[model samples]
Target: MTTTPRRYHITTFGCQMNKADSERMAGILDNMGLISSDDPNEANIILYNTCTIRDNAEQKVYSYLGRQAKRKHQQPDLTLIVAGCVAQQEGEALLRRVPELDLVMGPQHANRLQDLLEQVFNGNQVVATEPIHIVEDITKPRRDSKVTAWVNIIYGCNEHCTYCVVPGVRGREQSRYPEAIRAEMEELGRQSYPEITLLGQNIDAYGRDLPGVTAEGRNKHTFTDLLYYVHDVPGVERIRFATSH
Candidate 1:
């Protein structure tokens, strides 16, 4: 008798960032041999990659968590996780409210999902929201579209726009090396993805933290410079970006 593979369902709230994060988390689950499930109730792993950008988005996360938290009382083996901006902001408080959660990890910890989940399987509850230098995202995101993809050229933000929570939840600026970004795009091109959107909380500020100097002795790795570098990625028809602030 063969046992069925565990299935995962991720309910995401807010922005392309949240969607992109969910895709990467899904990729992590897929790499672990977990299958994606359409119905939340039917899955063995249920993840809420949440957002705190709005009151409504935050409330929706709690509502979803409540349902899953209650279900976990009966299904002790259920692996429930809360991840993304809200996870970073709330941290241990989320684990208090939804004590059934197996893991609560921030946006910066997206690529560390496998190692974190290993801890969960070892009978540990994990919270990983502490600020850390953003690691280069090497995980292949389970892209939502075959034609378009989100490539995180930069992680986190340094700006403190009056109404923004990104700088707080995502930590300070950290740009991926341009060579790594190009390699990711090149792979996407080979996979036949025609459009790639480079993501950042404050895209205009990308490359400001990287170590480089212009011919005139100014910072060299501006967004325009990045565009020129990535534009020639073979098979990529269009390149785009978000949140120029």
Candidate 2:
């Protein structure tokens, strides 16, 4: 007897950060031998990479989850996941709201997709919202663009602006090592992706959390310094960045 091949569909909502996170998770799934599916209803695993920056976005996640949750009743073997900001914010409450979910994981836990899914496969419902120092990305992203790519130079934010939910859900500022950032860019350059966007919740705040200082008492890894650092990577034609702050 032959077993059915695993298939997955991911629906992403919100910012470039969320989009980047989705691509990474897709890479993780791909590495696990799951084929990508365009239709959520046809896939064995369905993921909603969520956003909660606005009330409407948050509400939309629940609506999407409702439909999938209903489908889960008939397809008892289907795996359901809610990821990104809403997962971070709602935590176990999401499981309470949607008991059919197999995994509820945060933006910080994006790189741990495989491990969490392992727990799910073991007949466990997992919630992984606790803050962690982000693992250095080693998984290749299933990027949507052939010519452009997103390189995350930093994760999360430090600001507490009353108008934003980013800091609360994404956790504290965690800068990727500048060396790691450049290594990713170098690989993208090798892949012939001419345009690369550096992503951050607060782009200007890059490298402030790193442990380094210049002899002149200046930050050794400031965003300006980073720009100068990776400016001449081979095959990269253009670079851009996003800032929520």
Candidate 3:
């Protein structure tokens, strides 16, 4: 008897960070023996790792969700999930908007996909954007073929830039313990990831909110401090970071 690999289609929208998240998730799915489908209608599982960075991205995700929601009515077995910023920012409000969605999870919860899906197949819909300590990036990411990779030095953003919903949605700046960040970088080095981009909402303001942090050389113990902290992670050739406010 031959069984086809369970197929999944992931529709990604938003920035490099979200794209990175989706790739990591796709890696997780690959570990589970699921193949990705280019066609949305043909996949047994439909996962939308949504983005809410702009109004257009949010609306687009909703429109796609609507179509999938309607499809779920006809194909009762079609598993539906909405992940990333919108799922976190909106939470159960998403269920109010589209009750047909099987799961709603946020960026911080990205590493928990397999466990959440396990709960979904168990017949319970889930929303898991609650703030928690991002455990560790133990799952192998199905990275894009570029020699560059994004390594999140911190989880969540404390800077509640008024126009931004990151703090409310993704939670506060939880910098990975400097030690852990170095370890992750060391591993990436072993994998030959040549260029690494440290992720954050505001890199200039890293450890201001966290305790046990102080100045690093001429600067405060902010993202820059951490940069010096993990700069020597073995095998890493280069490093960079991004944030406007």
Give the TM-score of each candidate.
0.97, 0.98, 0.88
The 0-to-1 C-alpha lDDT of every candidate, in the order given, reads 0.89, 0.93, 0.82
TM-score of 2: 0.98
Candidate 1, residues 117-202, lDDT tens digits: the string is 99999999999987787677767788879899998877778778898888999889888888998999999999999999999888
Model 3 clash pairs are: none
Residue 233's lDDT within candidate 3 is 78
Q: Which has the greatest lDDT?
A: 2
Better of 2 and 3 by lDDT: 2
A best-first ranking of the candidates according to their TM-score comes to 2, 1, 3
Candidate 2 residue pairs in backbone clash: none
Off by over 4 Å in 3: 208-221, 233-235
So what's the TM-score on candidate 3? 0.88
- The alpha-carbon RMSD values of the candidates against the true structure, listed in the order shown, are 1.1, 0.9, 2.6
Please write out the lDDT profile of model 2 over residues 1-245, one tens digit for every residue. 98777999999999999999999999999999999999998998999999998789889889989998999999999999999999999999999989999999999999999999999999999999999999899899999999999999999988889888889999999999878999999999999999999999999999889997999998878999999999999999999999846
Residues 188-227, model 3: lDDT tens digits: 8999888888877666666665566335434245676787
On TM-score, the stronger of 2 and 3 is 2
